[model samples]
Target: MVVYAISIYCSITNDDSNLLVHEYMPNGSLWDRLHTYKKAEMDWNVQYKIAMGAAKGLEYLHHGCDRPVIHQDVKSSNILLDEEMKPKIAEFGLAKIMQTNKVTNSSHVIAGTYS
Candidate 1:
């Protein structure tokens, strides 16, 4: 099991938007769902499945692939819901390869934010 990866060569826009991948999720972000009473009551079973799915995805990122991948940002807002309420992760502008020994300062914090 090697802990190494290559950046997928995805683009980051001048506005810092990731241009490689993303799909439409009409329900918006997970934060929006948590804020609304109608969506706050997710069943334990469903949540468990979501957790398991995300874990598997992360595990795949870390080990299942040919190289070790690091998901730089893992936040609720980056996750979107399908019509069936299944989670689909979005936003990878901040992500990078795992094997790059050189770490830069920008990796330390969010861009354009008061820190």
Candidate 2:
């Protein structure tokens, strides 16, 4: 499985808020393809591929990096697909880089969407 490497470029918006730009995925997101009505049925092989790819991407973020990264928002919508249906992990807005490998709960408000 290929781990999707996201490239982020920061830009200042009109209101002074920061905006991040990412590469475009022609196939859109996994959620749209799965939940929304489509002519083609998603095959088991393709499903497995996407699932494995996403898992590996998370593994890379947590263990492969110099500092462990916790992706607070991990959902189907965040997993984008390329032209060939390869899964790519997107949206790092709620991601956190930890100083240590130890996983801990936070007292601060939990981040990410409900669904």
Candidate 3:
């Protein structure tokens, strides 16, 4: 499992807030590498590693964990890269923990951006 630096939940002025801290990813997101960053040319091996890491992370979330976590918004931007270009899944704001035995899950409104 990818270890996060720290997570804190606190209340300030009657308002609740949550914070999650992680190591700085110098390489930024995969989206930035592919679309925004100039001179960003990821080799085939690096790309393969990132793909495998992402797959393992998703596997852990879906089948390895006690409760299946569904990442509602999965996009290139959500895949963060460490200094070594290792991929780590981020941005779980739209994530959902489904009941293990539940056959189906439903939502009233759609979440996430279309484009």
Mind giving the per-residue lDDT tens digits that candidate 1 earns over 3-115? 11222345556765536534456766666776788465678876775566556657767667555556767666766666666666566556555664544445555532111
- Model 1, which residues run further than 4 Å from truth? 1-18, 100-115
How much lDDT does candidate 1 score? 0.58
Separate clash counts for every candidate: 1, 0, 0
Candidate 3 accuracy as TM-score: 0.73
Could you tell me every candidate's TM-score relative to the true structure?
0.61, 0.80, 0.73
Candidate 1, residue 13: lDDT: 67
Candidate 2 has an lDDT of: 0.79
RMSD of each: 6.6, 2.8, 3.9
**Which window of ten consecutive residues has the lowest lDDT sum in model 3?**
3-12
Candidate 3 regions exceeding 4 Å error are 1-17, 105-110
Model 2 C-alpha lDDT per residue in residues 55-74, reported as the tens digit of each score: 88888998888998888899
| Tens-digit per-residue lDDT, 1-115, candidate 3 | 4632112243234357666655567888878888865325787898898888888878777787688888877778888888788887887878888898985656676777544
- Residue 54 lDDT in candidate 3: 82
Backbone clashes (count) for model 3: 0
